[model samples]
Target chain A: MALSVQRCWNVGELSSDALRVAVAVSIEMNRDATPVADSIRLVRHSGESELLARQAFDTARRAIIRCGVNGFDLPAEKYGQWREIEMTFDPSNMRIK
Target chain B: MVRFLTLLAALWLMALPVQAQNGPLRITIDEGVIEPLPFAVPDFVAESAAAQQMAQQIARVVAADLTGTGLFREIPQDAFISQITSFNSPVQFADWRAINAQALIAGAVSMEGDGRVSVKFRLYDVFAGQEMGAGLQFDGTEQGWRRIAHKVADAVYSRITGEAPYFDSRVVFVAESGPKGERQKRLAVMDYDGANVQYLTDSRSIVLAPRFSPSGDRILYTSYETGFPRIHVLDVASVGRRVLENQPGTMSFSPRFSPDGQTVIYSLTQGGNTDIYRMPIAGGAPQRLTSAPSIETAPSFSPDGSQIVFESDRSGNQQLYIMPASGGEPRRISFGPGRYGTPVWSPRGDLIAFTKQSKGRFHIGVMRTDGSEERLLTASFLDEGPTWAPNGRVIMFTRETQGAGGQSSLYSVDITGRNLKRVRTETGASDPSWSPLQN
Candidate 1:
């Protein structure tokens, strides 16, 4: 339905040789659409690190969207749904150079 | 009749063998009139007799370099009361001071058996009656004498002015040729004095405003490589590059790195409107920082990263504004009568330099962080993109000449609006950014 993204600055000052990045994407899917694939990637300087931050993010996003669809008895689709997407920092994906 | 014959014979005799004295070389010394520091560079005398021509050539090159800056005037060789006959003897400073010279450049040239030329030059502050600095010697091929002279001049200029010498640095700019409608441009870099040029990119598409990163290892420029104006960062060391990511339905250009080299702040265009955006250097989605309806671009970060100075049209005309790094409402900082753009924060974080367009003319100007003390430094048909010197005392920018036959080149002006001089390039060049001294 709608997506929102936020950024963090001054992360370098916190650590000289390391950087921390987090992204939270909130999306609403159409009623007729089926959840097929989802991914969160943190990239910089031609390198990327991808992973799930917390298990609760996935559960809450799916739960809220499922609850918004078909009035709590939704199959895969019946009405549009709202989902919360979040990712966490992985040091391997971030480098000073 | 006998006395007249005797006088005529005496005159004829006086003119005959006296001609061997190399003709008194009558020379008029120009009077001091708030001109450049007057100095004399006598022809270098070689240690051995076989190196006469090379020695003279070296001194001539050094004299030319010093005079070209318009900051020094040279006394012609004919004005010299005595030719330099020995390099080992002490210099007669009083002789130069008698000619009202403020400074003197004296050197000796030598030739090695291997065909290399060695030159030793000394700069004297004639008024102080002291050698300004230690004498320097350079060894190079016969053809490198010109560069050796330039190096000597650079040293003398640095020692006298207390500013870094730019003569040794090279500038990279967009070289243009051909007609106005079908102009051909290529990325070219040349010596600071306009020599040793090498082209990096050819004009297959439009490229606008190429800027060197602080390290001089890369360049960020706006290019139409993908059939749309986009910002591309090129690695000067490797000639490799990559397109910066832009949000969907938006175009991005005007890229500059943060002082730490961790983020890039640039302008993103969407729906016929433009705003500023910052993204991580490693790679990530860009986050929009300004939501102004009018054009908001040329975002330069303060040296400490506490603030960002950018040009916005929110005031109904392009004006400079300062905003927090976290993105919030921007406060108006420029109240002048012109439209300002290309705001570049000074390296010292005390001033913001910009380009102001007014009355159909563009000018290079600077203002304080709070927008007070606005000073316009240069005005011309086209002058924009003020890049600060490493010490923040000078700014270099592009000056576009107009008319049936017009050209663009780089020029630098002191912060006080003095010392305006044309920066040389192989062809017509523009968009010069000075890099930090190499570590």
Candidate 2:
């Protein structure tokens, strides 16, 4: 699941200010591994500025919706185990500059 | 019976831990792809008959500005699954997503009876299925429609990238003509994208290194109008100029305005000794900043007016040094091999951009304020005189080709070493200084 999200995540779309912060998003998925519409939301952020936090959250939300359009590739038998997921997108290690 | 009930409650509490371990899965994603974001911009809807042509042109310019950044790729209209025929119409987010456009821009242009044009635009995040930010509108004259388009692009860029807007700014540069041996250089100002150029001075006398004031109201440049290199300040509005420093047997050039635009810091050469100096912009006795014996020139002030960065050969080779805004001992910030010159501090005050020469190639590079993490953005036969964009994310400089027929042209590169593009000009242009965003 992490690998699938990482593939769709475009960190380059984030601004420099947004890159300095980390955002955690909570998602509620249906039984088929497709994220429920309007269920992706930011749970927490590490920045003081609400603007930067929002920017980071928007990027994360876009990645989730973009990658989950066709549904995540997951085991349907373990649907109960992955119905609710928490994703923390941290860019500390990926800062090129 | 009470003892049995207590024992059963304790046993249930013990099982809670095992069940809690099966809670929702948590994942950390630290790696992500770095690629140009795909976007689509449909022709703006014309709200008036007179604005029909302006609407299409505005949309085209907006697309060009965003894609020119190299951080965005515009999806062709033919590939768009849905058409934006009306500004008030609802966006088909699913259609945009099917076409793989991560962002969408829709706008409208209207012309009032008083010869005023208004442009409004809204940016959308297709994948998120919502507007990225509140829609914005700009009003200007019909002649200034390009500026209006740039204003729209700036707002969209700032909202998406979380960076300040720079597209609404201007650049002052030296326009060149004739042969390399007898190049006629004149001072000219134009939009940041090299549109709507207006000449400030004639090419009869040679001019070099034109710098815009902090407020973009005046300009400082070096000219040989008096058979000697001297600094001059020209009013950007009236095009009237006067010699800044006229002491006999002394030369002054390479001038930059202080952060507050009240003082000018520059290089002055007297008795064959060159050093840095500062004086009032209204003409007064100059205060020498560096009394070093070696040549020192190309002085630029930090955004806060607390420090100044300049190039000097006091260390036996041309290198960058920072000193107090007032006179004081300077500290070297550049240690990499090869010679460095033309150091300009970034507007954000985090980095410094400079022109470096290594081996046989010249390059435009940027480093931290303390001269760390040096990265070259461009390498060519002759590249020099880097000026930062208003936002400091981009640097524009001069790139001269080799040979006798060689000509100088203006080029800008992203500080991240991407989007190196030649700016379009009517003639050979060089020594570009970008202006702050217009009010």
TM-scores, all candidates, are 0.66, 0.95
DockQ of 1: 0.00
Deviating ranges (above 4 Å) for candidate 1: A1-97, B1-35, B43-70, B83-88, B108-120, B137-150, B246-248, B304-306, B324-329, B348-350, B403-405, B424-426, B437-439
What is the per-residue lDDT of model 2 for residues B63-108, given as tens digits with 9 covering 90 to 100? 9999988878899999988899899989989999999999899999
Model 2 CA lDDT for position B227: 94
DockQ for each of the predicted structures, in order? 0.00, 0.48
Taking the tens digit of each residue's C-alpha lDDT, what string does model 2 give over A3-90?
A: 5677788877566777888999989998877887588888999977888898888878888989888887666886786788888999
Q: Which model scores highest in TM-score?
A: 2
Interface RMS for model 2: 8.0
Candidate 1 chain A: minimum summed lDDT over ten consecutive residues — where? A1-10
As a TM-score, model 1 comes out at 0.66
What TM-score does structure 2 among the candidates reach?
Answer: 0.95
Q: Which whole-number lDDT from 0 to 100 does residue B380 have in model 1?
A: 93
Model 1: per-residue Cα lDDT over B59-139, one tens digit each: 776776667555567888787765567666777766765675656777887887676878887877654455766888877
Against the true structure, whose DockQ is highest?
A: 2
